[model samples]
Structures are given as C-alpha cells and as structure tokens.
Target: MQALQSLADNYNYFITIFLMVSGLYIVIARGNMIKKLIGLAMFQSSVYLLYLSPGKIVGGTAPVLDPAFTVYSNPLPHVLMLTAIVVGVATLALGLALTVRIYEAYGTVNEDQIFARDNKK
Candidate 1:
C-alpha cells in the first residue's frame, strides 16, 4: 500500500517525462510540420501536467482571494499552466503557419522528398 501510494504520488511526473520524450521523438522522426506541431503540443501539455501535479492537494478550493474563503488553493501553478497553455497555442499556430509556408514554397510536406528533389536539382 505504501509503495502504491508512493507510485501514485510520483506518477504524474513520470507521465510528464514520458510525454516529453514521446513528443521529442515525434518531432525528431516525423517529416510533416503538422505532425511536429502535434508533438510540440504534447510536450506543452506534459509541462502543464507537471505544473498541475505539484499543486494538487487532497482538499483545495479555487484560489480566489475572498474573505469568506479560509483554505485557499495554490493558484500559482494553475496560473502558470494557463499562461503556458496560451503560449503553447500561440507556438502551435505559428508552427502551422510556417508549415503552410513551407508547403507553398516546396510543394511537398515530406522532408525526405523535399531533400531528394533539392539534391536532384
């Protein structure tokens, strides 16, 4: 039971690392920019997960500064996660826009194919 609890406590962090690695793998192995964006999103989400995991308490409220509220939750992580998510979304949008530009310029989305054609030329 103790081991199980310990595992549960650290599970989110482990998952976060796993997701980060998976995202890195996708970004490195995939040729399509859209796929890379998807991978980037996964990485961002994992970071959010990491932030949220630390702020978790058994009983917590939304960290609103109200006089009536006595036991306030840790809002720092949540706020940071929200900001991170926004930044991540912006990055993804930018990446997708860049992919569109790449497609327009090269007429192909595959990196290998583009390189091959370039080499031939």
Candidate 2:
C-alpha cells in the first residue's frame, strides 16, 4: 500500500518521533531525579538524530573537491550536531553532578519525598 511504503521510507522519522515522545513521557512521568536526567539525555539524542537525518544523501559522498562526485552531503548539519552533542554531554554531566549533591543533602532522589521533607522543615 502507498501508506505502508511511505511509512517504510520514513522509518527514521518515526523512530525520532518515538524517541522524542518516550523521552518526554519519561521526564514528565517519573519522580526520580536520575530517571528525569536519563529522559533528558534521550530527548537530546533524538534532537541529534533529527538534525543529522536530512543532511544524508542516498548516494552522495562527503563534501570534497572531486569532479567525479556530482553530489555531496551537507557537512553543516553534521558539524552543528557535533557541537550539540558536546553541549548535551556537558549538560548531562552537570545535571548528574547536581543530582548527586541533592541526594547527599536530602538522602533520597524522589521529588515527592524531597518536597515533603522541605514542607516538614
């Protein structure tokens, strides 16, 4: 069927969408700080995939000055994705570090427990 073929052709887009939704759901549904960080990382990874997907050409080679190659994949998106990945890593590290500090201070990573403790104090 046409719809099936289209879905097959755009499977990567489906995967990206699935990851984005699942990551957002995890972030919103979980109470543990570490789980939320994991979800955030998943969300970031989906973004990387989204950025990199369109720059790919089926038969294109890397951007190089070669007369034999008529088509070359765009390198700009890949470069930007690399920078994004680096920033994402830094952000994940900082988030984890903060989670560690919070756990040390509060003795638990559950949001509700932390809020309850704060309310009691």
**Best candidate (score: TM-score):** 2
The whole-model lDDT of each prediction reads 0.87, 0.94
lDDT of 1 at 18: 95
Q: Write the per-residue lDDT of candidate 2 for residues 1-117, one digit (tens) a residue.
A: 999999999999988999999999999999999999999999999998898889998899999979999999999999999999999999999999999999999999999999999
Cα lDDT tens digits, model 1, 3-114, are 9898797888889999999998899999887897899899888999888987876576787787876776688999988999899999999988888998998898788888
Query: Considering only N, C-alpha and C atoms within 3 Å, which residue pairs clash in candidate 1?
Result: none
Instruction: Indicate the residue-level lDDT of 52 in model 2.
Output: 85
When summed lDDT is taken over every stretch of 10 residues in candidate 2, the lowest stretch is: 49-58
In model 2, the Cα lDDT at residue 80 comes to 100
The number of clashing residue pairs in model 2 is 0
- Every model: Cα RMSD to truth: 2.0, 0.9
